[model samples]
Target chain A: MIARVVVVPRPQVADPQGITVARALAQLGFAEVRSVRVGKYLELELDGPPQDADRRIEEMCRKLLANPVIEDYHFSLEEATTQR
Target chain B: MIARVVVVPRPQVADPQGITVARALAQLGFAEVRSVRVGKYLELELDGPPQDADRRIEEMCRKLLANPVIEDYHFSLEEATTQR
Candidate 1:
């Protein structure tokens, strides 16, 4: 299966990276950019049924894919046909 | 308006970051993890109609959000309800 994961910092967390980019954009004259928050997009292939991938992905995120202390993660699984 | 942008490295580009994570996941015994590709997700707000946001977003990607030589970007815009 092909799994796509998105991990974003919680709203309450201080996003220094985002702030830095915002400042840069402001300096560059992109006034239309009101605000920005950065996150991670990950695509991976796993060997499992859709249900199994979902259950295991949750554990993977909690244990390794994301830092639950400050970030939240979600994923979707699709059948993969391309050879690895 | 709220815009969501996803930027990914070209498939031909070497993604050291993704490879590094894949190796770590393997070491951690998640053998089901076949491969990984890492990218960036950005959420930002702009003051404009959805169509305006789309046009400006394309310019932003060309000028800042992504490097055409190695990355590609796509975005979606939606009406934002909450105050900035």
Candidate 2:
């Protein structure tokens, strides 16, 4: 299975990286940009049955992939295929 | 408008961070893990009409959001709503 995870900072949390990106965009002439939030996107290839993938991925997010105190994570699993 | 951008390293590129995460997951007892790839996700809030948003976002990605030599990026735009 292939698990795609997205981890984002909680809305109330301040994101300096996002702020910097927004400022940089403005400087680059993208004045339409008002705000930006940066996050992590991970793709994990797992060799396992789909039945337990959700639980396992959830645990992985909580223990390693995401900082529970400040971030929230969600993932979707799809059957792995031979081609990219 | 709101744009969600996903920037990922090209497949041929080496991702040390992803390898480290996979190793850590294994240490944490997630043995089913086969491989991992890490990427960046950015959410941008824009104050403009949706018509020209795609062109502007493409330019932003080419100029600032992604490294053309090493990364590939794609984005989706949606109408911004008042509520979260």
Candidate 3:
């Protein structure tokens, strides 16, 4: 099974990296850029049945993959016959 | 307007970080994990109309936000009333 997780900074939190990048973009001539927030994307392939993937992913996020306080994670599952 | 860009390692690239992470997960008891890949997520808000955003974001990706060779980027555009 394949699981994809998208983790992003919480809307209310301060994102200094985003601010820095936004400033750079403005200097690079993208003056319309108002804001930028940076985050993480994770893709995982697993050896288990599709049924067990969601629960496992939730546990993974809670245990290690994501910071519960400052980030939010969402995941999607798909069955794959082989690794690409 | 808002643009969310997802940048991920190309499938053909060697992702040593992912390998290391997967190994750590196995040691932490996630034995079902076959592989892991990590990437970047960027959220941007702009001051322009939706019509100009797509081309501008593509240029942003090409010129600064993403490396054309080892990484692939995809972005979504939406109209936003205000920053949250």
Candidate 4:
């Protein structure tokens, strides 16, 4: 199974990194650029059936993969669909 | 523009967290699971023309959004395609 996870700042949170990048983009001639929010993307593959994968992964995310207080995480579970 | 970035453990890196999740999935009856790799995914929205957006965002990624030695990042620039 493969899991693609994304951890992003909640909309209300302050994202200084994103703001800083946005400023740089403007300086680099991307004058129309408005905002930039940085976040994390993760993909995991495990040998398993789908039945309980979501629940387990959700738990894993909350416990260590993501910080619930400031971030929001999302993921997808599937059979290995593509080869790298 | 929305840039979706993913930061993943290098293929050669040992990801103990991925391993732990894989074990849990197996225990939860995802018996067919084989291996799992975890990575990051980010979406950024910047109002801009397409011409210089990529280069600027790429730079932002390397400087702060991603750690090149241990991870890889990817993103896209487009007019807000889907509203969330």
Instruction: Estimate, for each residue in A1-84, the C-alpha lDDT of model 4 and write its tens digit.
Output: 677778889889998877877776677666665676677666766554578779877876787667899999888877767655
Candidates' C-alpha lDDT = 0.85, 0.94, 0.90, 0.72
Docking class of 1: high
- Pick by lDDT: which candidate is best? 2
Candidate 3 structure lDDT: 0.90
Off by over 4 Å in 1: A81-84
Candidate 2 lDDT score at position B32: 96
Each model's DockQ score: 0.80, 0.93, 0.87, 0.47
How far in Å is the alpha carbon of A12 misplaced in model 1?
Answer: 0.9
TM-score of 1: 0.92
Worst 10 residues of 4 chain A by lDDT: A40-49
- Candidate 3 C-alpha lDDT tens digits along B1-84: 989899888999888878887988898899999899998889998897788999999999999899989999999998896566
All candidates: TM-score: 0.92, 0.96, 0.92, 0.66
Error of model 2, residue B79, in angstroms = 1.2
Q: On a 0 to 1 DockQ scale, where is model 2? A: 0.93
What TM-score does each model's chain B reach against the true chain B?
0.90, 0.94, 0.90, 0.85
Q: Write the per-residue lDDT of candidate 3 for residues A1-84, one digit (tens) a residue.
A: 989898888999899989988999999999999789999888999997788889999999988889989999899999886766
Candidate 1's DockQ is 0.80
Pairs with backbone N, CA or C atoms under 3 Å apart (clashes), candidate 1: none
User: Interface RMSD (C-alpha) of each candidate?
Assistant: 1.1, 0.6, 0.9, 3.4
Q: Which pairs of residues have clashing backbones in candidate 2?
A: none
**Cα deviation of B51 in candidate 4 (Å)?**
7.2
